[model samples]
Target: MKHKTPLLDQLESGPWPSFVSDIKREAEARAKNEKGVDFQIPVEVCEDILGVMELTYEQKRTHWKHGGIVGVFGYGGGVIGRYCDQPDLFPGVAHFHTMRVNQPGGKYYNTDFLRKLCDLWDKRGSGLTNMHGSTGDIILLGTYTHQLEEVFYELTHDFNQDLGGSGSNLRTPADCLGMSRCEYACFDTMALCYDLTNEYQDFLHRPAFPYKFKFKFDGCPNCCVASIARSDMSFIGTWRDDIKIDQEAVKAYVAGEIPPNAGAFKGRDWGAFDINAEVIDLCPTKCMAWDGKKLSIYTPECVRCMHCINVMPKA
Candidate 1:
């Protein structure tokens, strides 16, 4: 049989590895001898996949088709309510797709955990998955109305995996890997993520607010996850106690040894780094002062903004 997309085939004629080429390879392999070869996909499914792959301005103008509402029992979290405009055309996918999976705290997953998850999805739903979608669930991309309960049961009872939130609920809380891998962390971000998720299961499954609320936690003021800007509810770990300063490490920084996390000094001045005049000059609160041999903190007025500590990690 000839490929329907001759233009997309032409794109593969060049040296560069086109994504369309990759999609074509997968489609070809599946059509020949693969598990997901023609499993309930639309007649135009290949064209639909290619349409998304090679998008045009006209492709962006898709019809507003999803007007139907659907939900599964015992959960308000996982069901993604939708309907195809022409249900008769897409009978296999007309009801809605469901998403239900427990997110690993700190985004940690063992190989066995991942393997089992994939095996289950291959058995129950479409083999397609998103490692994690924007909402931070292990997205099970396709399923029908009849199988939602069985899917939820197998996930919850057999695998011990809980469902993640959707709709106008508290979505699964996520965070940067805190005390596990980072030295700058003020708290155990992973543990907090787990704690919040478990404690707020009801809230996650129930929509109580006017709009969706998201929770993102960061271990330090560095905010590697950008939680502050994106999440509706953001929490970053901080120090209320005076920052621990190591005088010897300060000496090392001054001598330009620049030990990790203790601090880094301007390497310009060979052995005598200028501490006060240039380094701490522009602190918004002006709460830190470095004497010739020692650093002192006016702890009360320190706003915990992380400006000075970021520069001088050791000291």
Candidate 2:
């Protein structure tokens, strides 16, 4: 029967590795290694990759049966539970196995570190990876139960990397580009992230909470890391001091001497009046107003959100 994967098949025509072909390789390898074990390329995995379901269930029963709770000891932070409904049918993914590696602050990595990490995981665990999980950990999606400890040991003791948090614990803290690359930062988010993670190692490894909690930091109110929406504890840089007004700079901005937008938007006439209107509308306290060329802020009522300061860096 035809695979009915037109769009999926098209991916093979490109120079990039075909996702289907790769899984097919795994299927072939499984057939060779286990003489009597029956394993078929998972149609669900394929569907997820392409986001298209062209085929129906080939088996009356799939091998994905839910298993018992899955995790490693001493660390509540680094394991995710998964179960196959029909384990007898799918022996490979039978266990609710997950491996979580703590990510470095801000995702800054040298190619050497990446290469070494990949090599270790490939050697000891399943090659499949989520790359990054929702909790911002390096998610090794599958691994054998017997091999989890050894893999983690090698990763930690040898590579000096550690597992992230999971299940009702203080998860690995996350950070946005703070003093590193962004001028808007009021603090060194990277340094603080490292400090917090190291200090809270005990908390990360122990599940002592009523529910999972997360801490995330943003350099400024822009919150490029989605800290406010996603985290239970959100820290954003702000200033309590009054916003300094540079009338000359403001006039220059109004006169179009300064480029309002960067890159392709450079030429667009994002006049001062329009930008000011946008800023004023977003201010919750109704403390902002603009009259074509002049900008006014009710300093006393200002909440020190750093919103206007970030939006218009010149004024």
TM-scores vs. true structure, each candidate: 0.74, 0.75
Q: lDDT tens string, model 2, 46-161?
A: 22322222221333343444545566665555766665554443445555367878888887888998887756655444446666777778887665566667777888898788
Estimate, for each residue in 1-315, the C-alpha lDDT of model 1 and write its tens digit.
Answer: 132555566777888877566555544553553554334333233334554333333355543256344555766766775544444544434544757576777678889888877666555555557777776678875556666677788778877888787778888787888999988788988988888888888988887767788899889888887789878988899976777778887777666677433434434443445566535675778887777788777878777777666766766
**What does the lDDT read for residue 33 in candidate 2?**
43
Pairs that collide in candidate 1 are 261-313, 262-313, 262-314, 263-313, 263-314
Deviation of model 1 at 200, angstroms: 2.2
Off by over 4 Å in 1: 1-29, 32-47, 52-56, 86-100, 123-126, 259-286
Worst 10 residues of 2 by lDDT: 47-56
